[model samples]
Target: MPELIILLLFMVAAGIVAVEIKDLLASVIALGAVGFTVAIGFIVLQAPDLAIVQIVIEILAVVFFVAVILKTTHVDSTIGRPYKGADIFTFIIFGVFALAFLYVGVRFLLINSSAGFEIAQHYIKHGLTETGAVNRVAAVILDYRALDTLGEATVLFTAVIGVLAVLRLEGRKK
Candidate 1:
């Protein structure tokens, strides 16, 4: 809805900032902003599992980006630059957005917990019989949620490939 459109716009802006920023560290921060925004979008879309995975992956990506930038870049652009009002403004904006997301996520959880529990109960009660699996966990994972599990696996594999590609590029430069 409107919230999704706003999130998409903010994500695009962050992406542009990441591309246009002169400072490497700042650019990486902007990139992280884009990733975090996407995670929020996932949460808003009622996909908490995807949001959790995206948040974890985004954290790892940001860490890797910062480490690589620090190691490879010789010049430090931020050394003599004084803190600006824009910095404080950006921090405040992010804080507000974080609070909003937290509120929405909590509200969603409160509203959906009962429904989620019922689904879980159903799975537990019938999973083994319906799936012909030995255990409830196996039946749920391998039969009931197989597509979701496969999608998550694919995402992880793609992230690993991306990291490997970056490392390979760094090696080629050496």
Candidate 2:
């Protein structure tokens, strides 16, 4: 769709800005923008659950990045100079990560091909009756996948606690 294409373009531009910007804080903010854009794209694709998770993770990641940047020394003498070794190291690390992610994604799809469909069918057929809910979506979210929902809530809570801990200033007098 056109919206997805626009979102993809925005994400790419923000990613480039994040990587190329001289200001660390601005670069982090641009990276956060890319994450938020991905979340928006997830929503537009009708994956609200993924969108919610992405938004929460993006917020936590951005907060942590900002906190770390604030606490560390920002002076980089090698900004203008290109380090071939560092560049190659970074590229290799990123490539390995990307390959691992792709492998996991492919394995997940392959493993869940039929099982996922069966689970969906079960939920659709038995959701209201099993959960005694008026809405199918409510039944699926609140009853059928209650543990998954709880886990998501726990992750969000943990992320919030982490942000609070990172933001806490030590040795402040009352």
Candidates' lDDT values, in order? Answer: 0.85, 0.86
Q: Which candidate leads in TM-score?
A: 2
Least accurate 10 contiguous residues by lDDT in model 1: 74-83
TM-score of candidate 2 on Cα atoms, chains taken together: 0.63
What candidate 1 gets wrong by more than 4 Å, as runs, is 74-141, 144-174
Residue-wise C-alpha lDDT for candidate 2, range 1-174, written one tens digit per residue: 999999999999999988877788888999999999999998999877778879998998999888888899555455777669988999999999999999999999999899778987887788777888866666777897889889989998998899789879896789
**TM-score against native, each model:** 0.50, 0.63
- List candidate 2 stretches off by more than 4 Å: 49-78, 84-87, 93-97, 100-104, 107-114, 133-141, 149-174
lDDT of 1 by residue, 132-154 (tens): 77666567767888998899899
What is the clash count of model 2? 0
Model 1, position 55, has a per-residue lDDT of 95
Error of 1 at 78 (Å): 18
Q: Give Cα distance to truth, residue 134, candidate 1, Å.
A: 16
lDDT for residue 23 in candidate 1, whole number 0-100: 84
For this target, which candidate reaches the highest lDDT against the unseen true structure?
Answer: 2
- Model 1 residue 148 CA deviation (Å) reads 9.5
